[model samples]
Target: MSSDDNAAHMKETKEGLHSDHHVDILHAEVLASSDLMNDAFDGENHEHSQGLWQSVKSHPWACLWAFIMCFTIVMESFDMFLNGNFVALPAFQRRYGVETADGKWEIETKWQSSLFQAGQCGAFVGVFLAGPVTNRLGYRWTTILALVMMNATIFISFFANSLTLLVIGQAFEGVPWGFFIANAPAYASEIVPLALRGACTATLQMSWSIGSIIVAAATYGYNKRDDEWSWRVPLALQWIFPTPLMILIFIAPESPWWLLRRGKKAQALRSIERLGSNSNAEGTQQTLAMMERTVEIEKKLGGEPSLLDLFKGVDRRRTIITCLMYASQNFAGNLIANQATYFFEQAGMTSEFAFQLNLINSCLQFVANALSWPLTAWFGRRTIYLWGTATNITLLMILGICASIPQTNSTNYAQACLGVIISFVFAGTLGPISYTIIAETSSVRLRALSTGVGRAAYYVAEIPMIYLASWMLNPTGGNIAGKCGYVWGGTAVVCFVSAYFFLPELKHRSYREADILFNRKVPARKFKSTVIDVRENE
Candidate 1:
């Protein structure tokens, strides 16, 4: 045959094979969907048709496991909020402060800020370390190891006589902080049914607020004490949450997705059985097939999972969105809100009242976080993020205006009060919801690594903002007062814009569905409405 004729024939043959493959994939999808629907509608076990409450009722054990697992974040919350509370304590200041000419004692502003950021710096290290560790050890063991290390570091801080030692202890405590933050949401997302994913994943934020509230109350109870014991007592209390977490974590099942990736198909199926409400074997089998097929598709698209793979192709966009989502938590005035105790005290509220106010703010935040579960389940991540960002920006700008006014004692109190309320809104809405977005955005194979990298961005973003917060609010620093709000207000504007443009809604999307959507490069706005056939698309 002529060379041209042979080439044309070969091209036609390739097209015919491609067309046949497409037809076969579509045929398979139709068959799988038919089976899935039949299983979902089967007699008494129609989990797919059930609401969240019904699902919970049907799978009480699985729901309980998810709840217990989320409680681990309370320890993370305590560690995160402890520095903010302690930095505002007069007794803590007196213990660490240098005596001045007027017989007053003051902790150095640089140390005050750096001590808080020091833990975050350690968190940065832990965040990177958590990815590989979780990949190898799975979530349960990684968490146990992290909890042990966290307890050890907290004890070191509780005994330390020097600020340097205390800072080191805080830094080490952060290592576990990184581990928990990286793994907790990933774990929750994996174990919970898709119907409950929003509410369940949001427990990460809710638990953090619960932890913050406990510490705030602890600090309030100790604030009036005139010795080192005041701070020491609260620091010691860090051990409370982890003891139960370590015990409970042992009983929790490994993520089925993780097991499936590691080729433990039987264990993976058993995990699905334990965690899923779908009572029929057919339903579980369908889910397992979806998972396996999705993983296969991901393998084709991205080779094998690695740290470097997070930054390639569609994953690069996912990484950026995830990182920015985490960064948005801090940038959306989280640092300023976190330092509410210090800011209130600086504005002339008595130390006890400041702590009391902080306690109230924590309560408000806890309520807000609880509210977020329903809100997130109803509205999804992007809407909450955009709305929350706008709310925080307006509140911060108003606070800046209030702070910029000439200081009247009443106005100072007013600014502090307003700032606390604004912070509560931000915490309930943006702060915890960001974790959900990160968890949902990542590919299953790279979830730990993506979440770790995203969380590491959170700490990295906090570095400058922490110092800036110290300067703006500290008496010895720029003491920008409410003007710090202006800076964070501007940041919130940036966050709002980025989230509106880049953050896609993944409210009801399964991991495989999310993969297909990202693979197709769907516009952010279209995610909610776009229908994808995961089996056929591959």
Candidate 2:
């Protein structure tokens, strides 16, 4: 046969295979060759070969914008820590105290549990709404609106005199907290260079630790007070970060990816130009082209963006993996870290020491998150996630055994210390890594929707987990104290198993490359070795 005839035959065969859900070996080889040819011929010449430092030097403004936007995650973390800390406060307890058998003041278990649960519920609402809001308003405005809502809710909580009002205020706060959580990582991923995307998105986890540190310090300082002002002061302090952010956010650029998805090509170009430093122009253009091509391919495959699209065909896997990844954050025994102060106190540590331990844990988490930049650069996301989950399971099991022992100040202290170590591991690994995975795994057109759904899964996981943690620890409920670790230890085992089987290594896969891999139905184990010509793979 002539070469031209062979080419025509292959082309005809490829078209037939495209309509099928499965790809045969011959079809796969042809598609792979086509992609290779495209890469060889495509005019886009910029390389993603730059290291993190080189990328930062090339796009300083863009990196800074990503860092600043990621800082919003701190507020969400701060709210969670603030509620955790306050529940242990004598002053806070007295303000909403109910009589106990000993005739002493104590916050009811229901109120204690509902405070954080309310926030999670609100977060669920925000995650549900984030897709529409971000799609319509773009990243910058969605963030600004979240800040505005957060500030309003904080002020409401600052003035509330009753538990119901306070819980309501916290729920309101969760709305924007959810919005920021859903959108900020997506925004950072879109604006930064591919080499720095993991590091930048990981900043959300770092900011979360920073916020926890701040709340711990603030709560530690004020928990000693005897007035309503003790709790109210911390509630009011929520204004500190967002007030500055709201004003400064106007100066930041909208996500170029979002703009392009909306068909605003000129504005998307301007956004990319503004975000990238002058030296990064070529890379910016390459990135823009990559994004454009990914969107075009997705549109051809799935038509317009819809929430339902997340569950269809290849995206179904994306959505499930992303959701499971986010769920790993909660299921990896974070409950131990989240309620550390309470657990420490229950185990017989003084309130002061418990708060101090919480503060110390936050500091360690901050350091761990900082260290994760290099670690993430060095290792794949799946490796870190599995390792972290395994470590957490071991630590939680040991802590549970220690708690099951007879109560001694020394044993309690040891439990508190162990909790600190768990915090460090969780923050360093699953917390930061999951955000990057969720962002990387989703289709470009459904990035916002996928992230929102993933975050909703996170909150959904939290709903049952939070209630269980509360029931186990609350004096009026299960009051399991150190033994609570057993429950989470079991959960961590499940998380580890899921990650081993499902989480693919997305180490440096470009957005389009990921889509191609998923479309090809590549096994998770093969992702590291399966090289696709991303140039025309989509």
TM-scores across all candidates?
A: 0.89, 0.90
lDDT of 1 by residue, 352-442 (tens): 7888888888898888888887787678788989989999899889888888888898788888888787878887889778878888999
Question: What C-alpha lDDT values do all the predictions have?
Answer: 0.79, 0.81
List the candidate 2 regions with Cα displacement exceeding 4 Å: 1-47, 99-104, 280-283
What is the C-alpha lDDT profile of model 2 across 76-186, one tens digit per residue? 888898888888998887778776676756677788779889998999999989998899899889999999888778877888878899898889889998889889889
Which consecutive 10 residues in model 2 have the weakest lDDT in total?
Answer: 22-31
Q: What is the lDDT of residue 110 in candidate 1?
A: 84
Model 1 steric clash pairs: none
Misplaced by over 4 Å in model 1 are 1-50, 99-104
Candidate 1: RMSD to truth: 8.0
lDDT for model 1 comes to 0.79
